[model samples]
Target: MNVLITGATGLLGREVFRAFQKNEWNLTGTSFRRKSPGLVRVDLSQPDTIHDFLNAHLPAVIVHTAAERHPDVSLRDPAGTRRLNVEATAAIASWAATHGAFVLYLSTDYVFDGTKPPYRPSDKPNPLNDYGRSKLDGEQELLSRAQKSSVILRVPILYGPCETLAESAVTVLADQMNRLTEPTLAIEDWATRYPTYTPDVAYTILQLVEYHLAHPDFHGIVHWSGNEGMTKYGMARVLAGQMGFPVERLVPNPAPPSGATRPKDAHLDCSALEELGIGRRTPFAEAIQAILHPA
Candidate 1:
């Protein structure tokens, strides 16, 4: 029951690490730069290190969560981001295939153009930004190299415990509301999105891993998203209210101009995962409450 997780210090990966550890599984986690006490310092961008790390540890399952995630950052440094997002993923998948390991890659909902309302696992991907394109490419690389042994979980905007408010999208709303002195702050009014909780995603991943352990032949793509969809403006209002900030302070804004083209309504059809009896959707309001008042 050994599981190795990449990006173990990240917002999502941390939850996965804790979930597996809670179940008393042997866990090895990797970090790129920040030296967390328990994480192994392995730069996934380096193919040699990835190859060496996998060959040496050869965990039963590898949860690949490390990536260049910011759309703006990806647009600014395509080469640097691709090295980690696409190339490193390919190397890990190839190595895992040869070593008889199962890989669970965490992907994003941004792979779709917002023209579509609800995207399914079978739907074609039409990414709107370099970040999305890079993530889609990583998905392709892993599946191509390790088709029979890997599972791709396409997720939506994630929020969870982080060192700072700026780290999670939902919390960032509260941060903005807290800092703004003006009576009104503009929030994205047009684009529709689903905000998912990180711990719920970790729960889904663990279930998939348990199934994989029993059925090694099981391999395919599935998606998990929060059941609710709201525009960023709506989310801002909700978060503002919870934080005791006046809901009137939030104002609607047209989609902000950005170097990256973002999807307007990429709400995922998580029915595929739901049918599996493992995709437990978390309520956004409840998750926000927990974040606002962690017990």
Candidate 2:
């Protein structure tokens, strides 16, 4: 299978690229700054360039992972967020529709309001912040333009050693643990998100692509996430315990208002993906161990 992946340097995109490469699929990747052999440099913000690239490659599937993903950054710069997240996504979906390519957009659990636990695919989206709002706009545009050939996979926080978000947390906590000092300030009150390992998410995406190829009728939003849910503080404690760090270092705190209004709970249910026999929930301990010692 010929595949094109955007944001190839990102945590999830890199994993997807690796998965496809291992499967001996004809894979080409795109990145804005980072360059690698066989990787095409296509900035999504430039639709014309992306369109031309797509015309040249003519990939059977396009897995789009590029976006302004930082919630804090999005809150600070809504326009920039929209440019990359919404407009670029729409442009790509439009191009895919014209080229008869299946587009798979990587969405987020942030699309929901966070009022409910374990959000379903059919649930109405009530984004609480600009980041979520931008992503939702992209999702709606992709659905409207790409029609039945496109798939939208909404995932929650992804954890892995190479993952920026989780790794940052891990590194900070690891440093403190090494020094026998308490790592401070975890959000115990702000109940939010479960994490999917990068490999698991990548595997699911590959399966979804294959499924779609065999069953062209398969199209729509699918919730892909880890099986478990926990607060940020709870997750921290689990991580510490798994890594043999003192659990006393983990402290309960609240999420400060930083312009971005996050949903209290945005865990996604992956029954749709499970029904397809694509992916299962990975244990948190196993995920943490993988991060500490990747092999």
Candidate 3:
């Protein structure tokens, strides 16, 4: 079967790329900025290019992972980000509908306001920031346009192998600690985060693809999250202990209230996906070990 992966060079997309290839699926990956050896250069921001590319090589399934994912960046350039995250996604879904291709959109927990402790797939979304709003818009687009052959997976904060060690959410703390000449590293303690492993996400996606093949009638939204609920302070402390850094070096930094509001707790309940036997998670400790010692 042919599988297409957008943002194939990104942190999560790269893992998904390897996972699909290992299963002997014919894979085609796309990248906008980076020119990877196996990836085809397709800019999602350009409607003409995206449409032409999808029409040329219509894959059986498209794992749409490409987007302007950074919240701060989205805030800075809302219009530019919306073009790719919202409009581009709508275009992709429209094309997929016409081409009879299944689209698996990788969404985020940011769709919620974060006041809720654990959100479900069926829960109504109330986004707080531009990034979250854009993602929510994209989700709506997929549901309305590609309703018959679309699956949305709402995920949480991710950390894993990337082109650089600093690209991951958890390992970035380690990188910051390594660069700090000071003995202290202040981390945000107010917000609760579910730091998921990218490899585990990749595994879950592969499982979902197989299940979709078997059960063509299945198409809806699902939730998948890491087992642990941690704050940045907690994650930094764990990383410090694991990496032999001074425990005292990590300090608590309360969440700020003035700027772009981030949800205090956007953790998801994966029971929906778990019930279908597709929500597989890696323990945070084991994931930390992998981050520390990458083979």
lDDT values, one for every candidate: 0.88, 0.81, 0.88
For 225-246, candidate 3 gives per-residue lDDT tens digits of: 8978889889998888888999
Quote the lDDT for 135 in model 1: 94
User: How do the residues 70-161 of candidate 2 rate in per-residue lDDT, one tens digit apiece?
Assistant: 88889889998998899988888898888788999999999998888778999999999999999999999999999788999998877665
| Candidate 2 runs further than 4 Å off | 163-188, 255-259
RMSD of 1: 1.1
Q: What is the TM-score of candidate 3?
A: 0.97
> For candidate 1, what is the TM-score?
0.97
- Worst 10-residue lDDT window, candidate 2: 163-172
TM-score of 2: 0.91
> Which prediction has more favorable TM-score, 1 or 2?
1
lDDT of 1 by residue, 183-252 (tens): 7898888778888999999999999999888888889888988878888898987788788987877779
What is the Å distance of residue 240 in model 1 from its true position? 1.0
Cα RMSD for candidate 3? 1.2
Sort by lDDT, best first. Answer: 3, 1, 2
Model 3 misplaced stretches (Cα beyond 4 Å): 257-259
